[model samples]
Target: MLADGTIGEEELRYLADLYAAEVRTSDDAIGSFLDGLAERGLLDSSIVAFLSDHGEAIGEHGWIGHGIFHEEILAVPLLIRFPGGEWAGRYSEPVEHIDLAPTLLDRLGIPIPEGMQGASLLPLLRGEPAALAPDRMRVSQRAHGIGLSFADAPGLRIYFRRTPSGPDHLEVFDLGADPSEEHNLAADPASRETWMPRLERYLEWTRSRVAEDRAFRVKGSGIQEEDKGMLRALGYLGEEE
Candidate 1:
């Protein structure tokens, strides 16, 4: 699965088969659960939907963990079945994790407040194009605290992430051409003319949208002048006093 040739395809298939068995059982259970709710008069007016925040990586690109913005980690399975006739089906579209909230709100005819980044799922559900093109970019960053187990260097690095580059990317990729992401086109000179504007706009828009928790700063910091002086003695802060 990592393409290291250490593990055979047969082994991967076996694991996949095991997971598939579980999926079958789960799907059946969900159907039964829905049926039970229906019998209890709880399903007639309900809009049933199931969604995973992100997908799991089954050893793609030498990676086992999730959180990197790869398609394998971001493009999750989505299922939406309307209450009434003929709308039960699958939608093949590039939906983002952020879109989930907006979709539910729109379905209930509720007004989604401004600065919400996601779009409604209605267009996709109605068999319309959700735009197979890479419309939005997803980025993720992780940082460890100072004075922690790991040394403090302010770690920041972008990875190419995965093969068959889709919507999500830890770095950037041209989804139309380098879908597999075999090529490191992020630094390519030619891409500047094409993707730079979109990239800048997306970044700006992301910056404009604020999370309430993030907007508020921690007022009660334990690090006082003496603590800062001690940290500086240990070379934590710079020459600035």
Candidate 2:
């Protein structure tokens, strides 16, 4: 932006190139590993899964990390090949990491342990309707104090933030209108009426999830006052105005 005058196409192309290289390298490593497995005849018996925890933002909105809840990060590539089956196709459904445990157990006819998250991969293998359904909306929270959420249900909050400061930079985009999130509506008070209530509901849901995670144990909260500020900067503040 310093020399380019604005976040123009050239800057975006540069960032895309960087991420593309990472993807290529990742593909190479996976290819090599699969080759090794095939050499030992273990590829057939082995259920291969390729997954990434999250994605990086090369320069989207002047950000560089993976805190935003953009589809780029919330969504991941999942390829699973089971043993002894004609299941070799793409699954487009929005699956969660939590669903993995249950799916695997279901495939093997083994019981899934309690308190585990994730769905099963059997539907995809069987070419079920659920597997064809699009991914359900989801949220992504990172240690960087950035939080993001999405919903098919409208009036929901879909945005990202930087770490907190006095004048915290909150970037909330109406994904319904701006799917790319190229615009920042955080400082626009005129849009608050629609977003505030939705944001409140989102906050409640977030707090509930946090409670379930046992994050507020009070024994070793691990976060300090400044941490809250950081979260605020990242747009993770929970307290009300």
Candidate 3:
């Protein structure tokens, strides 16, 4: 569907239908699993969470895929059903994937390690206000090559590119005013004085984390031809693979 630059109405409808079908299938499978568990008297003792790493951009912002610092890709669905569904309500505040482990540990009565960067969301889950620190920021990154990352601050989001050639590039957006990210505020003089320093600090911290992660990384060879063929068949890898 994303082969061509242009996306027709038929493509859009097909994408929507495909997404709907996947959702229905997933729900049915989960429901069946839960029914079995209930029959075994174990349904009321589990915490289920449904989330996605990123969202797809069919044609938003003239883009057909994710890995961009756009709301269409960043804002994903997160549904958490606790053991009893108590305190079940919508939370409008921003949360990140890093918080999941800490939240789960906190809920399980386990202590969160000091080395973890994420704060627990247990208070919010209990219907209380769980405010993030003033300086706390959410960061998202690309997974391949000289990776790109973005720091999401209050009302502002700064995207930093860690390219191998030339100088690094930055793109800033005022999400409060333009949630669609239609405007670029990086060039605005007023935004620089406020956001640049924060971006620099966050970037330094992120670089350190990346370095530490690399220190413990394990190298792997390229996948086997059979595995590559299977990935291609599943529409995960490109046809060229």
lDDT scores in order = 0.57, 0.64, 0.71
| Top candidate (lDDT) | 3
Q: What is candidate 2's CA lDDT for residue 71?
A: 55
Pick the winner on TM-score between candidates 2 and 3: 3
TM-scores vs. true structure, each candidate: 0.59, 0.66, 0.73
Off by over 4 Å in 1: 1-18, 123-134, 144-174, 196-241
Query: Which candidate would rank higher by lDDT, 2 or 3?
Result: 3
Between prediction 1 and prediction 2, the one with superior lDDT is 2
- Candidate 3, residues 1-241: lDDT per residue as tens digits? 2546478878877987887798799889878987897898776788787788888777776666665656777788887777877568998877877778888898899999989877788887777877544334545442322334454555777776664457776778877788777888889998798888877787778778987766543234367878867866654455544
- Tell how far residue 207 is off in model 1, in angstroms: 9.1
Once fitted onto the true fold, the runs of candidate 2 whose alpha carbons sit more than 4 angstroms away are 1-16, 129-146, 154-157, 160-178, 183-198, 207-241
- Compared with the true structure, model 3 gives a TM-score of 0.73
The Cα error of candidate 3 at residue 234, in Å, is 12
State model 2's lDDT.
0.64
Question: lDDT-based ranking, best first?
Answer: 3, 2, 1
